[model samples]
Target chain A: MKLGRLNHVGVATPSIADSITLYRETMGAVAIGEPFDLPAQGVKVCFVDTPNAQIELIEPLGDASPIHGFLAKNPGGGQHHLCYEVPDINEAKAWFEAKGARVLGEPRIGAHGTMIFFVHPKDMGGVLTEIMETPKDGH
Target chain B: MKLGRLNHVGVATPSIADSITLYRETMGAVAIGEPFDLPAQGVKVCFVDTPNAQIELIEPLGDASPIHGFLAKNPGGGQHHLCYEVPDINEAKAWFEAKGARVLGEPRIGAHGTMIFFVHPKDMGGVLTEIMETPKDGH
Candidate 1:
């Protein structure tokens, strides 16, 4: 259950375009990836590369988007979650459950195309946490 | 103005001891640092090391602690800020100001013993962002 490298920091934003602009011109981020729609996940996402990790800019895709409530609470956006990689998703899930931490749901393919699951914030020091299986190609 | 590395993620917690336990037992963080008080900053701090970056757990030291308001709003505690390194703190401050983003204050020695300044959340896409001068030994 050792946490691996931090995969990314999820930031829920109202607009990915505006976020990209800020990351580029203001934050001097030079390796931002293209923004793409993830209809199944109900968000548009763009990854801004940092030296060690990434800043995931996520915008609500539809009215029923999961981040809608977060945006309503913080209209200007905010750090939504932190994703950390693990060697195996199921093992991580079981480890968390064994520790009496609530695993939000069954592991599923995540935005990074790897198995992932969310841990309940109440059980994770009030921070939304995502556990992800290391990508096969080592991203 | 290029960003150096993702230095750390700041997590505000009511108790650094409890946070450390969670990180060590549940998160399997093996490199948890000793908790220390920064009286001048009005916060108790501890660092949980990840392969790429660190998680800084902060607890208010007194009534005037800067994070008191944040903890009041989110009693369970929450992600407080994200810090990135820059080669030059002063240059970074000027760059952000020129781009119409408000630098919170003049650069001052931060927890890492490096010069750092914060950018207003409103001007930083809703995330309180800390820009730090890269440590001389390259931490």
Candidate 2:
């Protein structure tokens, strides 16, 4: 289970528009992607590409969204999770389970249209972590 | 200001030894650096190098260390901060200041023996951020 390269850092936000401005004006970040809704995930997402990684800005889509609660606690929003790429999602899942780390769910399609699964925070120190399978060519 | 590559993500741990085992045995990590004391920072530090970035395990060295407070709040340890490299520390500081982001203090020698400073979490979307000047050749 070779830990892979970082795919992106998830940043929950009250409003992606306002957060985009913060990244652009304050952080000098360019190449911001258009926002798109992910109803399954119950959030709207956008990618702000940086030098070495992407900053994924996410805003709750509705009342049932998990991000809604995070936003309630932090109106301005904050870092949600760190995602690392894995070559094979199944192999990664098996490895974590064998090591007694709790895998939150079975593999599912993630934001990038790639297989992904979250590891339980309690088992992963305290930080919520996402493991994503790298997208294949021409996806 | 160009955001250089991500240097490391700081993880506050109650025990570096336990965290190291989690990474080594659970995550299949093999190249963790030896733990070292950073007396000035009041923390014991170790780097779990990954393909693209690093996981910095930081344990409070004494009660005087700020990490002790973080640990008190989160006994299980958690993500503390995200550190990014900057080409010029002074320029980055000035830019953040101009943008109304709070710079915690004057540049000081960081654990890596390079100039670094913390940005207030409130101003950084609730994530403590560290801006470090890349170390010169051979430190």
Candidate 3:
């Protein structure tokens, strides 16, 4: 149950374009590609590559996305979660469960081909946290 | 104008003690120190050290702190900001100001002899971003 380096930073915004400008022009992160819609998460997202890692900016496409609810209430900005790289998702989940922390979902595939799991906010005070293991080489 | 590696992740919580437990016992992070009260910020905080950086869990003393407002509005969860390490606070401020980004405050002393500045949320589309520089040794 060791936490690895940060995997990515999740940011919620009304528009991904503005986020790209801010992170790109102000922070000098390299834009990886055009924004893409993830219907499963109900978000349209773009990734920025930093010297060390990446930043993810997401906008909700419809009411079905949780991000849509976040934007509806907050409108402008929100920080989603801090994702930490883990070596083993199942082992981490088992450790959290044994320690009285509730797991929000079973380990599942996430962006960057990593296996990820979320820990409930109640257990984390008020921050949603995710643990992931980078995809093995060659899938 | 480049985002650096993440310096730290800020988590808003009701109890730093409980948050520390989960981060340490489950995630293999070591607590940096006992929770410390930030009177000016109206909160108490503790740090968990990871391989690359640290995570800060903030517990508001009352309704005056920003964390308090964040928790009131979204009791479920919230992330404060992703702080980036910079080499020169003044240069970073100047560079971003030239780009029309709103600088929240002048460089101020931060934890561990660091100089830090915040970019206003309005300028960055709701993310209260920050730039920080480690003070020169023996300065």
Candidate 4:
């Protein structure tokens, strides 16, 4: 896979508000974005813009949300996955699949409104990996 | 604290050889550096250079290595910490302390042969962050 750039890191948190505070008041991150709900992904998301990359703060949308299990294991929440930009999603998918890695699902609209899919953790050196297509015309 | 850039992502691995295989053979990563031992840190390390940043693969050097605990929890190993370059280690330390965040210890020699310290995950949005002074020269 031709991983373009590390776009952002996914961080699972119990509360986006507290996470935002930690990133802002503590880390002095001034470019935090407004929290938004992503019902399809079963989580609320916020993008903390950094000079070189972004940090995606994820909070479980409901009790049944997939993130709930991760939060249960790590109550304080933790780093979820590392997402990298790819020039062509389909090419990356084909390459990863050919390498015997499992592509979790077909390319779907991600929080950034770009096509994205997750590669299984076991296939990605124990790190759940997200391959995202570069955002078109937007920062 | 003024974060410079994402230096490298530290990934705990059962075997750097296997991890290297994944990055090179599978992920099409080039410029993989030879593995070396960092006895002081109790880990064998390898730096896989990427276009934007590097991936540090860490394996236990001995039975008492700290990574053994993490590897035990995650048999296949997992992502450990995100390391970012800082212009001045001391200034960054003071800034983090003033923010009421815990700086692990005094600056010490890191894998890149630069002064580095870890910020407590509790204060870092549940992510163990490593702050390293920029290396004088490229790795």
Candidate 5:
């Protein structure tokens, strides 16, 4: 699957409020949109737009949230995954599987009403990577 | 400073060749670009293009490489930094400084001949962040 654009960089933070302060006051990232809660994903996400792409800071709401697990292991916030925007989720999954990369989950619906999937950390050289296909938003 | 499009994601790797294969074979990234050696930056970088942005696999060449020191502390590849394309480096640096973020270095020449500077991890909640301004290239 070909990449579209960098959709966002996902970060696991102890507190989204503090993270947003650093991203905005310190890094010059502006709040361009509203926050989204993915109940199924077990996290709340907020976006900060940079010049090139968006930075998504995620804080887990429950014990089931992956962010909670990540924070439990790493303590403070650390660099997480680099998400690549793809055009088609199925095509991307097929391409990744054909290449012997370990896929995390079957293509599923995600934030922004898009289809997304993840490549395991092992196949991606120890860094978690996500591929997303943006849905058409009526203008 | 506003971001442009994402230029690339920097993945710190112990073995560049291994990481490159994963990207090319598994992720469908094309190695259509040349390998760039940034001695001053202390690493050899290979650029692979995806549909939207690029993935840069960085390997430290010697003891002088910062990646080497980073690996010494954290071992295995980790997410390095999210570099945003900026229109003005000086302006961005000033903004960061005002916000109490430690600026790693003055805006200087960086890899791939761009003007770039880094923000200390202390301010970003443990993630290194960079801002870059690229000159118009003659094609």
Candidate 6:
């Protein structure tokens, strides 16, 4: 259950376009990826590459999007979650459960196409935490 | 003004000890640092070093602490801010200002003892962003 690198910080935004502009024009970020919709997740995501990690910008894709409530409370967008890589997703889930920490759901394929599961924020010091299996190629 | 690295992600918590336990015991993190109080910042801080970046846990030090209001809103604590390193502090500040982004204050000594300033969340797509000068030693 050893925690790996801090994979990415998920930022929920109202508009990925505007977020891209802020990161590129204002923050002088040059390695931002193009925004793409994840219909299954009901959101659009863009990656802003940093030397150490990436900033994941997410925007709701429809009314029933999972992050709609969050955006309702934070219309301007906000830090949504923190994703940390682990050697094994199942092992991580078992460790969290053993400690009485609530895992949000069964491990499923995440945005990066790796097995991932979320721990309830209440059990994670009020931070939505995602445990992601390290990519097979170690990207 | 090029973004250097994902310096650290600041997490606000009610108790640094509890957060430390979560990271060490539950998350299986072994690089947790001792917690210390920063009277000037009115917060107690601890650094949980990950392979790529660090997680800075901050707890209010007094009633007058700046993060008191945030904690009141999110009593369980939450992700407070994201910090990125820049080549120069003053140059980064001017770059943000010129782009019509509001800098919270003049560059000052931050927890890492490096010159840093914060940009208003409204201008950063709802994320509190800290711009720090690359440490002289580049730790």
Q: Give the winner by DockQ.
A: 1
Chain A (alone) TM-scores for all candidate structures:
0.97, 0.95, 0.86, 0.96, 0.90, 0.95
The fraction of correct interface contacts reproduced by each prediction comes to 0.88, 0.66, 0.70, 0.52, 0.66, 0.89
Please tell me how candidate 5 rates in CAPRI terms: medium
- DockQ-based class of model 1: high
Q: Model 6 over residues A1-139: C-alpha lDDT tens digits? A: 6768999999999889888888888988889998888887788999999988999999999888999999999999999999999988888888899999999878988878899899999999999999899899875
Reference-based lDDT, residue B31, model 1: 96
Candidate 2, residues B1-139: lDDT per residue as tens digits?
8556778889999999999998888777778999999888899999997777788999999779989998887899988988888889999999999999999979988878899999998887777899999878732
Candidate 1 residue runs with Cα over 4 Å from true position: none
DockQ score for candidate 2:
0.68
Q: Indicate the docking level reached by candidate 6.
A: high
Question: 4 or 6, which is superior by TM-score?
Answer: 6
Model 6's alpha-carbon lDDT is 0.91
The residue ranges of model 5 lying beyond 4 angstroms of the native Cα positions read B1-5, B72-76
Predicted candidate 4 versus true structure: per-residue lDDT over A1-139, tens digit per residue: 6546778889999999998888887776778899999998899999988777888999999777889989988888788998888888999999999999999989999988999999999998999999889898744
What is candidate 4's CA lDDT for residue A12? Answer: 96
Please give the ranking of all candidate structures by DockQ, highest first, separated by commas. Answer: 1, 6, 2, 4, 5, 3
Chain A TM-score, prediction 4:
0.96
The Cα local distance difference test for each model comes to 0.93, 0.86, 0.74, 0.87, 0.74, 0.91
Per-candidate TM-scores read: 0.98, 0.94, 0.86, 0.94, 0.89, 0.97
lDDT of 1 by residue, A1-139 (tens): 7868999999999999999989999999999999988887789999999999999999999899999999999999999999999999988998999999999979988888999999999999989999999999987
Better of 2 and 6 by DockQ: 6
Interface RMSD of 5: 2.5
Judged by lDDT, which candidate is best?
A: 1
For candidate 6, what is the recovered fraction of reference interface contacts? 0.89
lDDT ranking from best candidate downward? 1, 6, 4, 2, 5, 3
The sequence of per-residue lDDT tens digits that candidate 4 reaches over residues B37-113 is 99988999999876677889999998889899889999898889888788889998998999888999899999999
